[model samples]
Target chain A: MTKFTTRLPLIGIGVFAVLLLVVAPAVLSEHWISNLGKYCCLAIAAVGIGLAWGRGGMLVMGQGVFFGLGAYAMAMHLTLETAGPGALPGFMILYDPLAPLPAFWEPFRSEVFTLVAIVLLPVIVSAILGYALFKRRVKGAYFAILTQALAVALAVLISSTIRETGGDTGLSNFKYFFGYVLNDEANKLMVYLIAAALLVVCLLAVWQFNRSRFGELLVATRDAEERVRFLGYDPANIKLFAFVVAAVMASIGGAMFVPIVGIITPQEIGASASILMIAGVALGGRASLFGPALGAMAIGWGQSSLGSSWPEGWIYILGLIFIFVILFLPMGLSSLFDRAKGLIRRSSDEPGPATPELREVVK
Target chain B: MSVPDASLVVSDLHVQFGAFVAVHDVSFDAHPGEVRFLIGPNGAGKTTCIDAITGLSKGTGTARFGDKELLGSPAQKIVRLGVGRTFQTASVFAQLSVLQNLDIAAGLRRSPVSLLRARRGVDASVERALEETGLGTVRDLPAGMLSHGQKQWLEIGMLLVQDAKVLLLDEPVAGMSQDERTATGELLGRVAANRVVVVVEHDMDFMRSFATRVTVLHQGRVLSEGSVAEIQADPRVQEVYLGTAGALSGALAPGAEEVD
Candidate 1:
């Protein structure tokens, strides 16, 4: 069963990647290819959220804090490279005149520095926050509220730091990524492939972690924290490890989002964005292996297609989807397919050989 | 005997919730290899005493396991120091399979850094604990799907896997059927062979079977302490149990021995 579950996701991802690489260019326009890249970024964040919130039972509302950290780090480097030395970036000149670049933004001039910051900054922040929260034994709704507050605070701080953070407009209008012109069609396809490849890697990492002993301890902490404590394990430490990993994943997703989507706005790393990540995970089934990534991508696609046609009604559509998922499909879309398969197997099975005791025990 | 090298020693332990003292200046020594019963009426601070011993609640005075002080340590720290406990509510990992639950409990004693790299097989300790609790049959099933009696036994299995020198159990057989209770009593007898076992219970019949010595508490103080029969005949115990000294003396006169 474990082998089947592990292989199923790998096969699904391989087939999807092949389809995107071989057939997407013929079927989808350049704009749609760009949209697919954006969806892949959201799916990456969803996979992280699923690990922390879905399986680990942490209601992380401030995944945006890590996301923002990564986005800002990448955006800073891009803005600096585009502006050249000694000249202010376009947004900086618009927001504040005659002000030097912030000291923290100085190191991002080198691509290596920016890449390292994208991963390290989120990890450091998550480690600190997780240490404080988990060591104090916070869980359930309190954890959700704490993380949400972090998202709100980070967004507000970024918005208020007009000169450095580009205020509400954010840094955008990128011309190149790794010397490849962003406007070129081949470069766009490369971005999509990179996002798709990263998503598959993240899924595999999470899948392996879930099968490991840390995963068992995490699930145990989620279900019965007191029992875990009495067994000579600190539930806080177990939870903290999972939470930090999730935060780093979200940060990497946010970093990718900046280049693929050509924007780094506060709105993309705020309360709404965090909630959207959660909604996708819940709609897809948080605990199911591929649910969060698939669900987030689906939502991202819907927003691009449906929101464009009916901007005012897209949120309503998303809300309705959430309500439907929570009501009828408590186990999410994964269970729907599972139930279908079960029904098919039941119809074909012999009745006389089945034992009632076995059914009761299994149930 | 001269304390018999107690694994758990509580000296004048006092617990309070704001102004109300729930467990007041209670002290007892649970010797290694003895099953000690803490019996009391409802709201008589049996649970509070257990909480203080396990370091789950802050209390004044001293709780020591061997040479280490348990007063300021966290519950997890106390468990690591050779003390394990079960909740009154049967707190097993409801989402994990029975086998997974045992593995986690056993894995706790292992280094957290190496927990992920541990080989995938039931440790000998976990297997022995599961067999002792008679939960070997349904070990593959999720704990949430177990019957109420089975859940209680699974919790016992978890405690056994912890391998603590002192095991504190709060109402180990509170809601079990007759057969289940008998089985649980037998399990406790086997577990008490090498470790110090302290059980808080309201059922007098169940307490009398496993306890070598029993301590009775009333209004957060030790009302009496001795064998079950000795404490049952004490006048103060009579007043607390029968609600009147005269009624208790009358009830204990003739056929109490046959009932006991």
Candidate 2:
């Protein structure tokens, strides 16, 4: 029984992989497959949130900053690829036909640099930001506000810098991905497959983190910061590590978002975007292995369907549900699995000896 | 065995919160092979003095654990310097199992890369801590489910797994039953074999039974320091801990509070 229970996670992830990589594409239409791929991108970001906000106890409200970094990096490369050598992205040409491509945007033209930036940008930014905030023991609402402020600041900065960042509309109209036509049906499917596969990889990584010693320490830090310090761990450093990991995940999600969605805007990697990511994780179960991913997909589905029909109503409904979950189901919908398991165990063992009951009490 | 046989010495330790001096003019030295007890009234600054020594508070003092200066260092730095502490309330990782709590404490020496891997089995030190604290049976149980006394033991177990040279415990036996208190006293005796075990407790009986050396603090100042008998016989400790002529009766009698 114990072995079975322990293997549940491995089994769960296996099932999830099959559902995503094998079953979904086989059954779903092309459009739905693309939508699922987009949802997978958001789900990737949600996995990171689970680690940072849920397990590490750092409520990260500005994940959009990291997401924006990845999205912009990928978008820049794709945009430059579309424009070809010597020519500029359409927006840059529209603003000033003769103005040479900015020196900063020049490096992103390399596929290697863009790919590395998608991973490294968030690592660097989050490391600096995390070190500054955590070293000072800044946490709770202050940390949330600081992160949200950064996302808001980035959005404002992008909106104001039209010539530099294409203003608010963001860099769009991508033609190719890694030199392949992104608009081609097969290539589009490949991009969706990439997103789906990456989601699985993210899940596997987070699952490993959840069971590791570092994962244990992250949780210990979350529950008892001072105690962890007395145990010879700098709580700030632990939090910083989780924050960096989360940032990278959000970045990957953003990077994937561009090719699948075919757009990169300030609005997509801003305060609302970050909060929406959090909302999905919270709704699904921030602490559980599969909760954040499933929750994100659900939110994505809602946005594509219910949101498009009654946009204002969707906002109100999402708000109400979030408030409800925060108030009553702080662990989110995923805790229901644990609760159900507990019930089954109790009911099954009712007529047994008092030994298991005693163990249950002790547990 | 680094800096072996070193004593934890605190001299002229003064801690202030703005205008309020929490611990002023306090000095105490605890050597390995002795279980030191710091006993005082509610506001006597027993916890405060340890706070300064463990880098949790700002104070003007020289707290030397072996050759290392504890003051001015960060909390984790102080811990890394082989100083571990427990809070007044039992503060174990309630969500984790008793074994996991010890594992995390023992993780100080673990490499960053090693921390990424899950435990293959119980670590030697963690196993020893579980045996010492009598938590082996409940090793897999979440700390929250443990009895109150078990939680306190788990906290001590954490310090033990940390291999702390100086264990500064705050009210480790506040709500324990007589049996649990005895078990804890024995555990401390075993732990203090080659480490400085300093306990800040209110239980006079527990102190008299286990403390090899005693320091009595009153109003942020050291009132008395000696063997257990010497502290009990001191008129000042009696007066501060009790009151007036009742000091004489309170010191010798079992019903110290009633006499006061």
Q: Compared with the true structure, what per-residue lDDT tens digits does model 2 show for residues B1-260?
A: 22344789899999999899899879999998999998887778888998899888898979888888899999989998899999877898989988899999999999999999988898899998888898898888788878989999999988889888899988888778899989999999999988999998778878878999999888899999999889778888777766765452332332222100
* Candidate 1 residue pairs in backbone clash: none
DockQ in order? 0.51, 0.70
**Cα-based lDDT for every prediction:** 0.82, 0.89
Interface Cα RMSD in Å, per prediction: 2.3, 1.6
Best-fitting candidate, scored by TM-score: 2
DockQ of 2: 0.70
In terms of docking quality, model 1 is medium
Count of residue pairs whose backbone atoms collide, per candidate: 0, 0
What candidate 2 gets wrong by more than 4 Å, as runs, is A352-357, A360-363, B1-4, B245-260
**Chain A: TM-score in each candidate?**
0.93, 0.97
- Following a full C-alpha superposition, what root-mean-square deviation does model 1 have from the true structure? 4.1
Candidate 1's displacement at residue A165, Å, is 1.7
**What is candidate 1's lDDT per residue for A155-227, written digit by digit as tens?**
9998988788887888898877866788898898888888777887888788777877888888888887877
